[model samples]
Target chain A: MGEVIVITSGKGGVGKTTSTANIGTGLAMLGKKVALIDTDIGLRNLDVVMGLENRIVYNLVDVVENNCRIKQALIKDKRYPNLYLLPSAQTKDKSAVTPEQMKKLTGELRNEFDYILLDCPAGIEQGFKNAIAGADRALVVTTPEVSAVRDADRIIGLLEANEIRRTHLIVNRLRADMVKEGNMMSSDDVVEILAIDLIGIVPDDEHIVISTNNGEPLTGSDCQAGQAYMNICKRVLGEEVPYLDLEVTKTFFQKFAAIFKR
Target chain B: MGFLSNWFKSSESSSDIAKNRLKVAITSDRAICSPELMEQMKNDIIKVISKYVDIDTDGLDIKVTRTELDDDSGTVNAVLASIPIRATKPLRR
Candidate 1:
């Protein structure tokens, strides 16, 4: 049996779908059969980000409505052999699929793959409820900004209410320079407020944008963000991977001063 | 030197401000009680208490705050109400 994990954040545009794509791709690269489900229904972008937009024959709505088989809706990724995507319906709204339907769908998928990742929609509404109905664990994505952290806290409360006990956090778009200058919240600051286990801290990297625009994730490269996702994947698979050092490197003079002080 | 100190004080990073604000906001949000409700409750409490005593309503302080828990306990949400009474009236009088 596979574990179903939902990737969620209460606020939009905080990199939920991007994190899902990268982590799913990273797991596939590690030789695990992975299936990603886009549960954002009316505002689906997982397929576009995964570069499998042109191949979406049947979506989540079709599978739930019994218009197509689950296998028919699964879109195989060309870049990664073991990765697949179940795209969301663009024309249908959140009401197209009920929570029971989502639970059933994820339950069925759980038997076929090693991992099932649900890319949840923003907000704590029906879409959010349906996305987490069948998940075994949750990954709440948030930025270092106050608004994002606030929303993440609300989402964590909701998840706890749902009895999803294994929720962890992923801090995305962290800028080391800004954090060093005390102009932005560090990962530790975010963790302290949320009071959850920290699974990943992705640095703010331009390569993320470039890779997304080109319909490819930065998995098999030396990109900082990609490596962070890779680490998150390993952690998800029960590996004890240390967090990447996200602090700004000290200058030569600073290092010399530190040596003298010691 | 005074101007420099003032400048430095004014330049405290906004990140700290954001964190402090979020701490308060998140605590209040978890309580799930509105400011309007708290005000109404305060008024009701003062009115009830004033019926049998001479009280200073203006000096009353009522707030819904959160208490941090220790390692083995969970955080508690509580209502801290402080009402000052000047004197009590006899029930017969």
Candidate 2:
């Protein structure tokens, strides 16, 4: 059976949908059959991010409500033969789906896919509950900002309380220059605060905006953020990959001074 | 220069400040102890202590904090209260 993982953050605009899109594509790139489910009903964006919006004739609500079969709702990504997306309903609200319905839908998906990635909505509401209903693990995404970290902590606590014991932290949009200047929190700082194992650290980059705008995920891209997403995918498959170095380059004199400081 | 002065200043970076604030916020979030609840708790503690001994209610201090476990296991929320004692009341049989 496939492992179901939910990418969630309690706050909005913390890169949950983007991470979901990238990780699902990365897993498919690894030749694993992957299904990406967007559970953010009434506010669907995963389809747009995955570049499958125009092709989504059916959504998650349709499959769960028996309006359509699961396979019919699944939109196969043309870029990756193994990748598919199950979009969310833009017209229906979150209450249209329940935890039990989501659980059943994922259970059916597990039979055919190697990985099922759920892109959860922001906030700990019914939508969040539906998204996590069938999840075996969780990736708590957060930015380096204080508000994002705080919400991530809350989400982690909720996941633990709900008995989803396997949780990992993904610190997104980290600015290396700001971290070097002591102006922003580092991924290490976020991991320490959240007290969860760090899965990946994606640096802030304009490449991500470009990719999202182009409706293409960072796949086999050499940019730092792109490589970071691929690294996260490798780690998800139980491969040990060193984290990307996001440190600002130090001058020789600064390196010498650092040796003395140590 | 401001940059030079900042380099010489204490390690009170904004990130450090953010970390400190997050520590406090997460601890409180875990405890789910609000300010009003904390105030009520303090008053109740004061009321209970007042019956046993002469405590200065005005000097009472209470806060919800997190402390690391002794066995290096994990941290837990703790309620720390500091109450000033004036004079103990004699026990009456």
Candidate 3:
């Protein structure tokens, strides 16, 4: 059987879709069959992020509603043969898919894939419930902001209440410079406050914006954020990869060069 | 004098402030007791305690708070209620 993991954040705009797209792609690159399910119906963007929006003829609602078979709705990524995306319906609302339907759908997907990732919507509403219904584990994504961490705590509580005990915390957009200057919380601080196992921390990288705009995941790229996503993927696959050291070390030549400007 | 006083001043960083606030907020959130439920619990406590003694219901304060665990590891949610007794009921013969 395959593992079903849900990527969730109580607050929006915390890079849930971006993380899902990159991690799914990374897993597929590792020769694992991966299926990313966009459960954020009516606000579907996973298809766009995966650069397969135009190829979507059927969606999650269609498959669940029996309008199309699971194979018909699954969009194979042209970039990776093993990566598939089940897009959510743009016209349908969260109420369109029940939790039971989601459980059944993920159960069916588990038979054919090694990993099934559900990109959950923001807030603890119907969308959140449906996304986590069939999930064997959860990845709670948050930033260093106070509001984001607060919402992550609430999401962790809800996940525990729902018996999803295999939850891990991923701190994204951590500014190493700010953390060194004591202007932003470090990953250690976030882990201590959340009291969960730390999965991976993705540093603030401008390349993420460029890749998102181009509809390409930054997993296999050479960017810092791409390396971070690849590390997260290895960790997800049960590899003991050490955390990335995000500290900025100025070389002696750069330090010598700065003396002339001062 | 400026540098000397600046050194003595205790200035908390922004991240420290964020961590402190999140710790306090998350403690209450994990308690899982809504305000409505707390009020209901207070009423129930009054009903049970009023039979043995007269409590100053208006002065009663009840809240959910985190109490340190006995093993000194962490904290757990505990209901701390402060009820003032007006008078004790006389015992029946």
Candidate 1 docking quality: incorrect, acceptable, medium or high: acceptable
Worst 10 residues of 2 chain A by lDDT: A157-166
Model 3 misplaced regions, further than 4 Å: A251-262, B1-10, B34-93
How good is model 3 by TM-score? 0.81
Query: What DockQ does model 2 achieve?
Result: 0.49
lDDT of 2: 0.90
Query: Could you tell me how far off, in angstroms, the CA of residue A168 lies in candidate 3 after the best superposition?
Result: 0.6
* lDDT per residue (tens digit) for residues A1-262 in model 1: 9999999999999999999999999999999999999999899999989999999899999999999999999999988878999999999999999999999999999899999999999999999999999999999999999999999999988887787878899999999988876779889889888878899999999999999999998875797888899999999999999888877688979988999997
- lDDT tens digits by residue: candidate 3, A21-51: 9999999999999999999999999998988
Predicted complexes: DockQ each: 0.35, 0.49, 0.41
| Better-scoring candidate (DockQ), 2 or 3 | 2
Off by over 4 Å in 1: A250-262, B1-11, B36-93
lDDT of 2 by residue, A197-250 (tens): 999999998999999999999955999999999999999999999998887798
Candidate 2 docks at the CAPRI level of: medium
Q: Write the per-residue lDDT of candidate 3 for residues B1-93, one digit (tens) a residue.
A: 545754775798778988988876675676577656766778999999998899999999776554546885544457778999999999767
